[model samples]
Target: MKNFLVHSLLLAVLLTNSCGSSKINKTSNPAVPAAQENVSNQAIVPAADQLKAYLPLLKGKKVGLMGNQTSVVGPNNEHLVDVLLREKVDLKFGFAPEHGFRGDIERGEKVSNDVDAKTGLPLFTLYGGNAKQDSIVKSIDVMIFDLQDVGARFYTYITSLHRVMELCAKHNKELIVLDRPNPCGDQVDGPVRKDDKFKSNVSFHKIAMVHGLTVGELAKMINGEKWLENGKECKLTVVPVQNYTHSSIYKLPVIPSPSLPNHLSVRLYAALCLFEGTDISVGRGTDWPFQVVGYTNPVYGDFTFTPGEKAGMVKHVEGKGAVNYGLDLRNINPDEFKFTLKYVLYFYDKMPDKSKFFARPEFFDKLAGTDELRKQILAGKTEKEIRESWQPELAAYKQMRKKYLLYPDFE
Candidate 1:
């Protein structure tokens, strides 16, 4: 206990001294939209920024933090883990989700149990498919979840959210989700996961491709709907984002993952991510990942880029050692971007060999949350026809979504 206190004090001092009075800009790049410098007059304050509201809850409890690189507080972007330590919150252990504690781990990479070197805290991996963190969940009095979500269903942090919530419910531990603005909170398009066979880590719940709910709002839905094992409900508390509405054009203070480097990449992710199931590369392993899509063939497009390995970010480079040709969308206005199926459809239509287009059909379906989409594209269904087919289910989901919403609706 004495050593831990000493270490905590040192960390606090180091962090405090490092961040004097210099405020970090929302977006480092001048080209991308700035953070919370959106259309709304008020800046969206994340739940983590309001420490007073939640610190009391952890005053004496053995708290466990489930967070990643994006789990930060304020303009200085001090990590919540460090902030909690500074506040003398009895944080027992740290939990890492899909991207690991620092968010360096590659997408879909298996995170293993380890210890956080910085804080000397035991780190358990919740990204492990099975609920192996049962013991960790039981040891904690409360689990604080704070990860930035990109508002896409297949992003996998939400999957980690489900597993953590399930374990919390089973062990009878309180789960607190620190809400952050969904970069694309207003978007609620794409096919809702309806098929049981399509269930995977990516498609954890039956929601639209872009659910448009903040983590806090989604937590309410998860508990309210009784989606847990045997309809179990977690003792959930959601610290919602202040001055945020569904329509608020909030930009992320930090990149959610390594691939989504800028505001534009994050905005385009929902649309381009579908290309993961295809032979085409979504600029993975490149500096501008998710901001461009290309293939080795010159017929794909005039714009060209080469995919290369990025250590800890992407281990296996997709479309490596060859020039890939396709769209360059780094300069597109993020605010104007809307979730659409047209990009993937265009690539599919261009592919000379239809079978090669869906290089990983099963994986594609898992990402889509339904096999119907692949079948629809294969059948050459127009975007209009495809969107029309989703209306009935989408309409029902929208109605159900309203019950759990914590902010004003976009509509």
Candidate 2:
């Protein structure tokens, strides 16, 4: 079984790499002048200036924008909805993702529908029950999604995109994805979601946990693969970001989500989220969620407990507080780095006081997308051994993802 999993992963990786070279013919080339390209390439101007190409296409269309705070125009931090409205684009509805339109809601908290203070438009909640379906978007001609994705598969924003795309296909409505940079770039990592075991709003389709595609690229992949219900396809239009390469990490003025305030939080989300399966606080109900993980107990050895204003733990080290007990390696060492699966396995192997670490086996199993990660942790497998067990499955997933990638190969 372990050998089969490793082989499947390898095959997927190879397939993904091969698919990067495949290209589809374009029907018609939009007339984008050389001056515009030059202007877009300039570092002084906003990298998102390429969105101007779609202005002619969206001039007078009744549009429903599916976005949040991060959906801004450029360095001026101009709101996309406001820009469309000012341009007489007939902006109708605005859909807010998990953290509400303004990105104020806390994690796991329900966001209620309300009227936007600035635009006076009714803001719909896509995070709640029955909200992520097609029923809410029936009043508009085109649904434009412009949220910033942190490039993690389990992040709710990607799932929100997935459901919105599915709904657009069902309603036969035109879907426009305003492309943004993937902060994590094109580095695929971790395991793919298994078909039979894990399927949720978070893990809807089979993709690596740290999928390295921009939201627009993901939309293209999903449509090209016909991953929507009954193989349905939406009238998709992707407004690609000009001058934006896979290497560029865009520092947008608008916040993507509440918990993910900065690139630091986003960089840590994929690794730290593993603690969610454990009893650790994960710094929820505090200023920094996913930045720190700790519990109330002080009895655990090798760590000193220092209480913060909001019940946190700091290590014995200077300047570092107690609410943080786990590995705090922020800088990714490109030379020494392995895949996320291997990194996670290493962390699990070095975990201190396994008995004190409160992780439900079922919860860990679900979060990891399989029972294998959990079983290996419990079985006391060394990090090397655990990673060796997953190489085959990871390789298979990499190969399967090839045909779905939309960006140039950097690997």
Candidate 3:
């Protein structure tokens, strides 16, 4: 039986690397984006972002939304945008974050202003600061932010939420945060961003890397902590998730971004993404964008993946068309995940020449949210020593975080 299982696993890995796979099973008739497919609706109660939960708050308000493909309503999997327009919610315009409204764009790819073909609503990019932000805010009385966050500080969705909330506060408009589950639930691990100098599109706040809060909970913290300008809070309301605790495992209803296509990738992302600043490609331009990591040469490891085009498949941005050699990590169980550095330490130590491992320190530092992580790694610090250094900030962050939690906590 063990032999059979081992052969099966090898075959699966071979197929994954063969560039022969397509998106996981469809969520609808024609094809729903792979990210929209949820794992057994029975496992989760309703998310606060559902229209049923937030419709009353939206009624009679001129609503603008900062949402993406993850915002769905009910078991039919109908989009919230569609449901609102149908019910006469008077949604004025739409705002998109990193992945664009439909969630198809690759990581770091520019999403241009466009019209929603289905609703004909004007959509503006919120991935960075939108130029027409002032005008857009003035036109709407209320803004709704509903996106599934992967519970990492640097995931960029929450950063977009921060920027949007800041603008809302400046305009004095009420913003309602429709909460959803954090997939890496209740796992508040990793170092906090030490100071503001490290802020980027990735790390705009000083939260721990894997903050164990939902978007709504984090919004409250953002306000309660006066993490905004001049210590003014945005007029905010957070509709809380039902039947959720800090520890509930949420299978995401949609892919949070183009690269993070599944739970395993999302779990691995916070830990492995530090590699972004190094020479290793995090499987970009390949079918397994975030699930695995490798260098651009065959000598790097035992496995190889040659990326090719598959319609609707998001290719890696850095190593497109490059055959990368590294470990096959498709079998990793998300249930066993934690914020970790063992993988990076293992891979970096194995590389024949350390000089070629890192590409730029600035990008890595931004992702890490501290220069100390980079310095520690370069200084040959063991993973244990690095983890020990995060204790002081982690303790403080945990205390601050406790003040804003809306659900039963893991602690």
Candidate 4:
């Protein structure tokens, strides 16, 4: 206890000392359009930032946080784990998803189950489909999910959220989802997941790839739709962000994943991630990561980038020790990106070697949540045809999604 207090104090000092001369320009209300957003404005306050509203519920209860480095609070940008410790909230064990507790681990790298070095708290690994264990869920009275989601189906954090929600429902544990903004909340593009097949860790729910809902709203849908075990809903409580709406443009204070290091990358992730199913390198080894898509071929896009073994990019896709040339999309404004299939279609049409383009067909199908897309792409269907194919399903999904929304939607 003494050691934990000392560590907390040290963290407090470290965070306090980080008070820079530059003011934190948080948006006061994000109900306006993105083009109107300014440096002088204050954005919507996240639910985690308003601790007083929900911290009382955790008093005298064993707490378990299912979070990562993205789980932060306030204008100062302090870690939620540290804040809880300071508040004397009894945080029992922290459950880490894909990137691990502190989010230092690489993407899909199996984070080892161990104790947190700073707080001395036992941190369990929930990746690789391991959090469903009965032993872990029963240990906590309240399971707090406070991670930032990029609002993509393949992102994997929401998959963890789905599985954790299921476990919480079955175990009868109080699931508190401290809601954060969906950076891609405004746009609802791409196809929705089919009912049968292609369901995996990435395709947790049947929503569209770029599902425009906060974690809280999604949680409500999971319960409302009776998506849990035997149609049982989890005891869920959503701490919603203040002054946030579906149209509100949320700039992530921290990168949600290792590959997505900035707003541009996060914006491009929904569409560019499709490149993963192909032989293309989505700037994995570069600083841009998801912002650029490149390969060593004349038929590909004019822009080019060579992969390298760098931090956050421990392994570059298909570019091991070799330079892969492709497009560099950094110069383009992220807001201009609609996350449509135009880029993917264009690349597929240009590549001379059609068979060699998609190395992992199954993985691509998994990401898209349907083999129909691949079939359409292979058949040389136009982007309009493919997007039109998604209309019925996407429309149904949007209608269903409206039922569970916690705030103003992107209507």
The best candidate by lDDT is 1
Global lDDT of each candidate: 0.75, 0.58, 0.71, 0.73
Q: Could you tell me the lDDT of residue 257 within candidate 3? A: 65
TM-score against truth, every candidate: 0.89, 0.78, 0.86, 0.88
Candidate 4: which stretches are off by over 4 Å?
A: 1-42
lDDT for predicted candidate 1 compared with the true structure: 0.75
Q: How does candidate 4 fare on TM-score?
A: 0.88
- Candidate numbers sorted by lDDT from highest down: 1, 4, 3, 2
Give the higher-TM-score candidate: 1 or 4: 1
TM-score of 3: 0.86
lDDT of 4 at 53: 71
List all candidate RMSDs to the true structure: 8.7, 10.0, 11.3, 7.9
What is the per-residue lDDT of model 1 for residues 81-167, given as tens digits with 9 covering 90 to 100? 778888998888777776666666777677776666677877667665435466766887987878788999888778777767777
Residue runs of model 1 more than 4 Å from their true location after superposition: 1-40, 129-132
Candidate 2 has its poorest 10 consecutive residues by lDDT at 9-18
lDDT of 2 by residue, 99-198 (tens): 6666655555666666766557766766754534456667677777777777777677777777677667767777777777776764777767776476
lDDT of 4 by residue, 1-411 (tens): 222222221111000000001111122123332433232335688888888878998999998888877777776567777889989999987777776665656766766676767778777766765534558779889888887888898888877777777777777888787889899998887889986598877676789999998877777777767776677767777777777777777789876667888889888899888888888778877767887776777567567677776665784455655566667778888866768887788778788878987899998998999989999999989988988999999999988887666666667
Worst 10 residues of 4 by lDDT: 11-20
Q: Score residue 111 of candidate 1 by CA lDDT.
A: 70
Report the C-alpha lDDT of model 3 over 147-260, residue by residue, as the tens digit. Answer: 778988788888777777777778888777777888897689888998778888788778899999887777777777777777767777766665667777777766766678
